[model samples]
Target: MTTPPDWSKEEKAVQAVQMAFDLSNDIQRAFRVSAALQDMSTSDMVRKVLQLPYQKNRARPRLTITLKDEDFELLAEKYGLDPLDRATIRHRVSEDLRAFAGNYLTES
Candidate 1:
């Protein structure tokens, strides 16, 4: 098991800063695909590529993704929920993810 970076430590303080870089769409897709194949997050993959120490299990253990208004509308239609209800949509998405992981584990 790997340990997450300690923000309280001065040497690991830099890890507190969030950073982003512009990359080509193809590169982004490829990187995501590779990470998924290895069952790792893209952040962990980037850390691995840079030879930086990273934890497999993060302190927060939560997944996040940016979604647009259009995405919410689409998801609402797919799930037969009200588009304006963001909280319910979020809860439904979480439930779907949990169900997916359960199904995947049983199949494997």
Candidate 2:
């Protein structure tokens, strides 16, 4: 018997849209471990958790924040993130804000 061929990379990529979502720190860590084990992205895991349609496209807006070099370094240290990479810093801040929003909604 012959094994089927794997999907093309483009085919796989087009099956889902990439977007960001937040989990609690503990939950985020757990999902990170699970995603690593499965060799999947955390965004895909979040899609599973939210039961979003696999092929749907959602608008994702960008946010910009400006900070002094010293202030940026302080935030990086506080969040335990790398200060040199803007994308990583933004992603970390987005995750933290999402978690905060979730908590706020739950408590209100």
Candidate 3:
């Protein structure tokens, strides 16, 4: 990920900063739709939206996991995750895994 430019009072008030992003077409389309729906410039919308998780004091990191279909289904059911939604699956699994790790650490 690219580092965001500093937005300080001392910095010059530039109308916009151009940066190239290597995002998937689907993501680009989604951002465009969201910007249109909110009646805002795409750049402004993207900046505001991207700041949300940071504002919440949440860390955004990438993780990859491989599981058999049956295993995934079982975990999804146990965690009340929707199998059709990959985002929900990932969120549920991350939450459950973190909880498990915490419990294990405490018990140890």
Candidate 4:
């Protein structure tokens, strides 16, 4: 059977760095892993070391919230729907709002 894409040495190095460890150790482990696993690129090797969810996963944009869990819960309860279920509903609402706003948002 044909093979899947392999991780490169550099990829491995990066992955090791991302792990919860010292920077020097991560770099060393990365090289060792790349050689042991026969990774194609350091990039790919890093992906393997980290056991990341996807091969081509790009960074997600982050949204920061200053609210504490208790405070957030109180706010969420006031709005309706348990905080636990808000994530899914919020995504749908966000998409709908974006589509409705569309070019009008940019024009103004």
Best by TM-score: 1
Cα RMSD (angstroms) for every candidate in the order listed: 7.6, 13.5, 16.8, 13.5
Query: Per-residue lDDT tens digits of candidate 3, residues 52-75?
Result: 322222133334578877877887
Per-residue lDDT for 89 in model 2?
74
lDDT of 2 by residue, 45-66 (tens): 5666679643233234344577
lDDT of 4 by residue, 42-71 (tens): 454555667854344334433334656675
Could you arrange the candidates by TM-score from highest to lowest?
1, 2, 3, 4
Model 2 regions lying over 4 Å from their true place: 1-64, 106-108
Candidate 1 global Cα RMSD: 7.6
Backbone clash numbers for all candidates listed:
0, 0, 0, 18
Candidate ranking under lDDT, highest first, comes to 1, 2, 3, 4
Q: Which wins on lDDT, candidate 1 or candidate 3?
A: 1
- Using all chains and alpha carbons, the TM-scores for the candidates as numbered come to 0.51, 0.35, 0.33, 0.28
lDDT of 1: 0.85
Query: How many clashes show up in model 2?
Result: 0
- Which residue pairs in model 1 clash with each other? none
Tell me the deviation in Å of residue 92 in model 4.
Answer: 8.1
